[model samples]
Target: MAPLRLSLACWDYDRVKAIEDGRVRPEGIELTFLNLRVEETFFRQLRYKEFDISELSLSSYVLTLNDPEPPFIALPVFPSRMFRHQSIYVNLKAGIHSPSDLAGRRVGTPEFQMTAPVWQRGILEDEYGLNYDSPQYFTGNVEPSTTERTEKVPLQLAETVKIQPIPKGKCLAQMLADGEIDALESATAPSTFGTHPDVGRLFPNAKEVEQDYFKRTGIFPIMHVIAVKRSVLRENPWVARSLTKAFASSLEYAYEAIHARGALRYILPWMQFHVEETQAALCSEGNDKWWQDGLTPQNIRTLDKFLEYSFKQGLAKKKWEVKELFAPGSLDAFVL
Candidate 1:
């Protein structure tokens, strides 16, 4: 029998590099990995369903669950995860010295439903007494020269939630630096953050803050998941498990490369110290540390918390259990 051919749209993440380089092919599948940025992959997949598989935003993907016929199913294959403390940028004029001061402020974001913002809002609300509904939001591009970017999936915000697009020719980064927007929450750092003196990170001590949060909660937020077209899953049930295994293998490959301390694989001067810090913080539950792939209780709880965040923020109509988000065949692959 001929192998099933599949195309996957996602960024060139180090964890997924083995798959991209043809060193980790899914069983019974011939894969074509599309090296796309998260924004491009998300826009194409959510707008046009352009790929057989895609790296989908957790918030956007969960919102699609509200559709009568959800278009995609996922495995426990998370391609991107990050601690979002560094994602929040603020204007020096905003008078937001601490998280509590962000209440009733003007905030700009590329999209209200982007995963990083979702995580940031959730974390702020959960840990710092910042209400999810407090901010007045403006959506636009981060770079001043580009046109505003709208949500990939339209949002039906709660009556109390206030949000709108930034004015024409205005972008989030520039608006933030100019103090047109008091703060910005996004996955990508603004070009103005370092160059423009007015714009600075909300949490300047981000590494310390994020490390403390992880130690307290053990919740490393997942940004993107590997999703397959639901129609394709209906035809080839085994694809889910095959792809999951492939992704798991790819992560292991990444771990091996990162652990070769004798000769550093990356260019960082403190790569060894960084790896040791990560292991100390995240390795207690599993050998994979921050990149664990299976649907362990920890992983499921992380997904559940994110879904709760999406629903509470009015991005999803209702919260969904983690099992409902992935393929039936893939569910069993999750280790206890």
Candidate 2:
């Protein structure tokens, strides 16, 4: 087969290799992975057909559904490491004691429509039974300073939370430290950010979320999914199936290897983030409550539920059924 050219916007050098090793077609299929963030630049490339595949949030994808262009294959749901666990953090000295107290508080977030606020609010409502009272969003200004640039996405949940545009260049951490915002919807691992002395926790919602998910459903909600252009899949269906298998197999391999004592030394080299720290966070903060290795029917259903709620919240314009979104043969009966 000819070499498959692909573009993975997210920079997960280690994780991609793990997928390539496990899932690429014909064993030794050449895949060119480009390191780029999926921003307007990516959309521009898609219009020019400069790439084959890219990662996209479901909400963002929905906004472009009206275009005459082909749609991307929503790869098997990979529960976001962040949303799989909800970590409700607040300023320690704010005197806020519980989720209930967060009701009128000024909360900061990068995006409202994105997963950050959706899942964060879910935690507050579903678990703590508290209303965060629509978060205050920070839409980094146009030509925002470096700081503002980092937080530019518009708020999807502003109706649920207040929206505030912090000037560019100001560290969100500093805002948290100075009590400008009581909390931040850190959609990634908490360790992704430096340990903040001011940002203490009332309830480590990340751990609580996993527990709550397991109690309600058999799996944790799926987060980010590797998206493929639907036209590309129509031309080559096997590629989609192969990619799904590869992703699941890679994750399974990682899980098994980590359990086989002494493998950490070998696995450490492939990790982009600190291996020990990520591993520790995985162990302490990891949500295996419903993880049976990789994606499962329950996982897909969770994603559907999330999308449904997102659409109602206006984060997404339409509801994409699981069968319609995922590639055929992508979801196997048994989790690896």
Candidate 3:
């Protein structure tokens, strides 16, 4: 077989796990890795067909699905992985404890159309009737494809809620600490915020929103997905299973490695600033960690929800039967 040609575009978070940890090595697969910011560059790449497979936001999937050309499909690589919390956090001094307190305060998130922000804002609007910022009025990147535009709503409400975008991961925490920004996207849950001294705790009312939102929608806003192009699947059908197997193996390796006595020592440096714990808590249960048990039907359902949302939100150009997103039995392969 000639060298299999493929490229993967992923977020900074997954890149560290796949590359630095030696999990998704490119040596045997003829894979070229692409690290991209999930921003305008993301849309530009899709428009130009620069990547064979790339990670995309659930919201982006929804927006792009509406487009007529360069038809793409989303595969369920890791679904509803709790990739991060994307919560609402305020500075201790801000005197804010609930979503309602956000009335006139500026809130910072990773992006304008990011899953976290959309979900958070949706909860505020749909439930609490809190009006979020207007498309142009907010501080974050307002990409038409990824974010929704609400028109004719009270401009006062939109202007009152400020949306500031922060860089991914640690930068999000650092900005909260330095007071460069107030509140966080809260992508990671408790254990993550506990790692930072400046962040006191998630907004007191966040749980209600999460629970109520999940109850009504049957899905949470996803942070990111390991998406692949439909064309790639045609050229390398077996690659999907190979990746599924490799990812399963990697998860097993990460789990055993973290649980093993001395393994924590090796993983510490690799996950240091990226994750908060010392060598002792490398594998402790919390935050957006990978699953050792591998993917499942529920995972697929979660991915499907995002794709469905993409279709409803006009992210995907056309609707796809779930099978179109995966190999014939990739779903079954992961389950067994």
Candidate 4:
């Protein structure tokens, strides 16, 4: 039997680099890897099913569950995860000194339904006492460029929460910098803040805040999940396990390379110390696993919380179960 050839689209992260460089390959499959920006990948994959397998936004993926026939079925492999406390950017002139000040203020975001903003909003509401429904929202591109980006899925916002796009020529960063919006939450750093001194992060000690949040919540928020097209899964069911095994191997390979004490592979001078610190913060006491994959207890707990947040924020019509999110075969490890 000939091996199946499939297209996979995702960012070129260190964990997936082995698979991209052909050091690791999915069993019985030939992958054509497309290293693309996540937004483009998500847009194409979600809108047109552009690739056989691709990185998907968890929030967007949850929204698809409400569809009668979702175009994609996910694996438990999470390719991207980030602490979103650092994602909040606020204008110094907005009088928003604390999270509580965000209540009744205008806020801007690239997209309300995007995973980072959803996580930030949920965190603000749960941890900091900001009312989720109080702020008026403006959604637009984060960059200063004139190009506009729309939400991939329809939102189900509360009647009291108003959201609109910025004007055709403007962007969220500019809106935030000019004090047109009090704050902005985005996955990508807004360009204006680098040039404009007035724009600053909401949490100055973001690392400490994020570490504290993780210690309290036990959730290092997941941003993206890998998904295979439903038609491909229906035809080649074994591909799910194959891809899972390949990605896990790739992640292990990345860990070994990162932990090698000889020299720094990354640009940062204290990279090893940072890596060790991260491990201490995120990993369980006995295990060396920092960036874990699959639907383990911790991962499932995080996913369930994210789903609840999505539902509460009106991104998902209903709270989805973890079992329904992944292909059945992927829920267990395969043996040779």
Question: Please, what is the TM-score per model?
Answer: 0.96, 0.73, 0.58, 0.97
* Candidate 4 or 3, higher TM-score: 4
Which ranking of candidates, highest TM-score first?
A: 4, 1, 2, 3
RMSD (CA, Å), each prediction: 1.5, 5.8, 8.6, 1.3
User: Which candidate tops TM-score?
Assistant: 4
lDDT of 1: 0.88
What TM-score does prediction 2 earn?
0.73
Per-residue CA lDDT of candidate 1, range 1-336, in tens? 999998999898889999999999999999988999988899899999999999999888888888999999888888888999998999987798999888899988888999999999999999999999898988888886555577889778898888888888878888888889899999999999999999899999998999899888878899889889999989999998888888888998888888887887888879878888888877775464677876877788899999999989988888888888888888775442
Clashes of 4: 0
lDDT (Cα atoms) of all candidates against the true structure: 0.88, 0.55, 0.51, 0.89
Clashes per prediction? 0, 27, 19, 0
**Per-residue CA lDDT of candidate 2, range 142-205, in tens?**
2224433442223344355456667657655567667877766655433313466777655666
- Of 1 and 3, the candidate ahead on lDDT is 1
| lDDT winner | 4
Model 3 superposed RMSD (Cα): 8.6
Tell me the spans in candidate 1 whose CA falls farther than 4 Å from its real position: 285-288, 334-336
For model 1, what is the alpha-carbon lDDT of residue 202? Answer: 92
